[model samples]
Target: MTNSSGTITDKTGAPVTIADDPDNHRYTVTVDGVRAGHAAYADRTDDHGVAQRVFYHTEVDEAFGGRGLATILVKEALDDARAQGRKIVGVCPLVAAFLKKHPEYSEATSPVTKQILDWLKR
Candidate 1:
């Protein structure tokens, strides 16, 4: 997988940075070098570096809504996960909804997402 580096600026000219925190194994997304979004997760492995259960929580700045910043964040988060060879467990409603709307991105999801979708089925 190709990692998108350099910078992706928001409408206000803020550079986007999606970084994974080694300690928490979560992601912190920044725009223009300032925090615009974040996602917390749990990464567990057994005798190997493989990820087990990755529960995620993501949120976007309200001011950045309607501009697809949330989608951008999700895309970056999923891209990072794919590069790291990890699956996702989206605990955030925003991410869950995004997944429901874009089945193409479901490749990043874990088995738990199906259970979550059971309740989210329309």
Candidate 2:
């Protein structure tokens, strides 16, 4: 069963919750009601005018490290992007690695491009 806020139990059995903070352009993950990590992203339009969500970075608190929180955070962020009809661009190494291991998300994944990188610099 899932919690109303979409909480799930992590490997350590702690209640984990992931939510999008659009105002900050990131998805935050919480463990037992405390913030654990976040996957940062930027919304932009691609050359073809397609909406894209570029995941640029992912970080978990030192105290929350090694708990599989980053994986959960990225998965939730990617899923959210897919649901919102935005293509996923994995600029962050962690996110890129996740995409490599998860082929199911390929349909929604976009290759990182020079234009996207330039946009991110600004």
Candidate 3:
């Protein structure tokens, strides 16, 4: 998973890379060297604390969706965050929903997610 030049090639020659555009606070994920997924966020610091509000999106290409490409993108996002020691604010409904189903990923959510438990209310 080397991010050299913002690309990671799989063993079968399929490459997936993620890019962080600090100016826009967006990250694009590419598969086999092609754009397959994306995530955007707003980073802010205030009197309470600093937080990164995030959202994720994936192309509807049949070749990508059915293959769990979005999940892979989420995994990559989590892995990247782990490496960078950052907490996330899951503003994307899909990501927020995912965190609800996977408690192990709770740490990946923002500090306030417990209060945002609308998903669990049902």
- For each candidate, give its TM-score against the true structure: 0.66, 0.93, 0.63
Off by over 4 Å in 2: 1-7
lDDT of 2 at 38: 93
Least accurate 10 contiguous residues by lDDT in model 3: 113-122
Q: Which candidate leads in TM-score?
A: 2
lDDT of 2 by residue, 1-122 (tens): 24567657677878989999999999999998899889999999887999999999999999988888899899888988999999999999999999999999999999998988999999
Name the runs in model 3 displaced over 4 angstroms.
1-13, 56-63, 111-122
Clash number for model 3?
Answer: 1
C-alpha lDDT of candidate 1 relative to the true structure:
0.64
Off by over 4 Å in 1: 1-6, 45-50, 63-67, 113-122
Clashing pairs counted in every model: 2, 0, 1
Ten residues in sequence with the least summed lDDT for candidate 2? 1-10
Estimate the overall C-alpha local distance difference test score of candidate 3: 0.59
Task: Itemize residue pairs with steric clashes in candidate 2.
Answer: none
Q: Candidate 3: TM-score?
A: 0.63
